[model samples]
Target: MAETEPNPLLRYLVSDPDAFAHNLAKAFEQAGKAAAAYLKPRETGDTDFGSTDEITRITKTLAHVGEWWLADPARTIEAQKRLVGGWMDLMSSTLKRLSGEPFEPTIRPDPKDKRFQDSEWNDNAFFDFVKQFYLLTSRWAGDMVEEAGDLDSHTRAKADFYVRQILAALSPSNFLMTNPELLRETLTSSGENLVRGMKMFAEDIAAGGGDLKIRQSDYSKFRIGENLAMTPGKVIWQNDVCQIIQYAPTTETVRRRPLLIVPPWINKFYILDLNPEKSFIRWAVSQGLTVFVISWVNPDQRQAEKSFEHYMKEGILTAVEVVEKSTGERGVDTIGYCVGGTLLGVTLAWCAATGDDRIKSATLFTTQVDFTHAGELKVFVDEEQISSLENQMSLRGFLEGRSMSTAFNLLRSNDLIWPYFINNYLKGKEPFPFDLLYWNSDSTRMPAANHSYYLRNCYLENNLTRGRLELGGVKLDLGKVTVPIYNLAAREDHIAPALSVFEGSRYFGGPVQYVLAGSGHIAGVINPVGKPKYQYWTGGPPQGSFTDWLAAASETPGSWWPHWHAWLTDLAPEMVPARQPGGGVLEPIEDAPGSYVRAKA
Candidate 1:
């Protein structure tokens, strides 16, 4: 009989016995390191790995979901039937494929789901079945949460968010055995991949202080003021809370009114000055606008007592004062991004109440004044969670940056979390160098009093929109902010939903031009004029519902920067000889992208 060739599929079962043994031994050593890293924090009295409060909250919320399903037998039966029916169809399809008969998949992942992009997921019967089964179950679970009519909106939102996370974690693509690509890598490398992966896993845990800070990008590949925040500028003012950097003039003539940017303390301000190509700050400067950005300090125990009121006073108001002193302009144009935008709104209201009109025009970027439709982030902001977080913060005097970073990552776990997990730990590969992810990983700590006040007043009570919020002993009324306002919202923003932003526009007392941009929170705002990857929409006013406003809006191609500049010019069109940093009044403290932004969390 002729010799039979071995099956290609079975090749993974065979390996060089000595090489396999060697890799296995090395992998064990790495595993020991990982174990030690995990326990190091516990040895230091930081044993709250799986938070009891979070566990209890999740259990109670899931129980509420269970109660709703159990309350009606018909609903329960319907859900089981839906899942079972999906499985039966998937099984049928698999059987047909095995018999060499043409058959369609019982279900398909969303087009945007990158996890199932591997061809083997569709070509291989086993993986196809695994993918289909997982999708079926996940869909059934989501349906149950959505149909739980008795549950309150918050509970429903929490359940939905949690279910999605669970499903994302449980995806077949996350497992080496179930993921064809990982299995192939493991087989071809004779398990050497696992050894390398385990070593990296240990190193990452140690780097995170036993908290497992997954490296989203090669941190060593980038550095602030060198390649990342490389925009030319000088730190002209400094306070305990922040360092205000005034960028050097890019043009011979610049806008008469200086531009002060109030970025959120949740992250560093360098996001706006990421690079020459993508930097919104650099682009704004090139557009002949004198730009000053607040680089918020990474708060520690010493700064724990700083409140939201302190940020308003020492951060925004102080930056405004310094800008006025430096530029010799009493009135200036201001732009705020994310939570900073929220603070700007409050400042505008406070200014309105106090009869201060230094903020000539206000531009808000993906900022939320109303929490009613605030997206998935609200899941982490309920009374129970906030109280638990406050308790934890009280012990440390500040909330760890990783906690917030983790929460934000969880909001898009499929895209952000699981991909890195599979790549770094299963494939033994380093994440590609990405400036945005680098900035994202570089997070900032939140002051205890400041974070607590924000959660309670904004997310918990929805105080700002209600005109019930007070700061500096003055009540803020959004309706009284009569400054000509330009409100920009990202259509797909998870942090600040377009609907929520639109609702906020109605509260402003001035003429508001509500613009809807493409993409999510970060990419939406940092869109550069040189490279136009997304489009934006412009409507008369943010009237009626967001859906209606979008329907009647005019679509414009490319970045929203030029449109914003045009609006700024319309507000204050005068151009003057460009002023250097410090304006010969406030002495330059240091080069731009100063020490404050470089401080690690």
Candidate 2:
């Protein structure tokens, strides 16, 4: 039997078990040294003040060790050899369907499916063994204070502080140093990295560590267009994230009615309206779809008081009112992605719960209505992380785009985060200026109140889907939304697990279409036509269950955008004849894709 295709996330995770283990061990080792060196007794009041050379040596040593382990020549070859075999296994797994292997679900089937979560629970059980391996080493946690404890804190308070740091880092859950057989070897090469990280953090006040290189001046190029005027295109309308100017097309030119786009605040909105050529908004316009994108205000320390509720009011709702009033259109088709999709879902529910169904149809791209099985992120979304983020946002008015970007990057350390570090910091090479990275680095801040509320409610509490999340003083029951729904999810996305996203199909009633796209989190949405990229598959208009649908779904090549365009063309209000700027649906004074150009980070 032919093997089944490998899940990207799993492939990524198990890419090189040996190398992964090796890197982790090295990281640990470097971290250990970094910790020791950083915590080494500094002569109190002796103005040498810990020479920069000392601190930098520790950081470089840690980074060097981590990089070495991550890209170890022998390790890489071994990992590659292992992955080749794994790929064959993966291919064999994929071919099984053709060879008539009964079935193996892409995601663990819900217990409701009358089935176990996995066809192969044994492997998961093994991983569970690996994870739980720590508990087996109870002596490790209670083991003598290993590295930093050796430091002469020279005072009780200092010693206590050092002890507290050790306790915080060595919790049973974070006890990565346990099981000397498994991880310590890897740490041997990389342990100093961790310690160095701590010291750098400790000395940040003096070092201006605030220089988190979130935005690269030359990293990404934000290209401005010559056609500054908001013009009707294959799309209906467009808004700016930078909110540089407020210019909706003029009324006389309003023949092309507005279709407003709402993107998740978690990311810069330009992803949808990326650029003229690859721009989805532009594509929509070319198809004679009137598009107006909501360019969210990138908050700063000044905007910390803003709440999620305030955003909806000033964000989508406000945009709707402004567009409708300008174009004299009674309703608008609202499209959203990720957080935007969630927001869109909540907003739609609010409208329905309140009996305000002004929206035509709702399209959710890679958005999850349910948060169960949020995947690897569930580990990091701990209460403390949320609180730390909330406090940060409290002072900054929102979590800086860089902080959020860093968190997401960590999810795919080998791919997103480490590769760049290796390329730039390790090899002493400049990273090629890529627009996506630029956009990514150009992150926007969420208001403090809203960011905190979102993390606690959506991630930590998982309340939004559990029927507990209330927005704008309204209980956001997704079941309340009656609008025809279009949902897209990426099969390989670790960020929003497919199973979690499939839960959307159940929440939103009405004719629902869920399409599994070919790319990862961001690439899926950026899917352009003719990329000959990943194939998409769909189940049924009358979908049975997520599993049933997945099984019955047929595959389609290239991006889902074309299919969406076709589907949307069917749903789209017939295109009004082309009109001059501000002639029909547009108001001349407002902007096109406003508020998108600011330095997000």
User: Which tens-of-lDDT digit does each residue in 22-67 have in candidate 2?
Assistant: 6546545654544444444333321223236434433443343334
lDDT, candidate 1, at 240: 93
Best by TM-score: 1
Clashes of each: 0, 98
TM-scores, in order shown? 0.97, 0.62
Tens-place lDDT digits, model 1, residues 187-223:
7788898898999899999988888999999888998
Which residue pairs show collisions in model 1? none
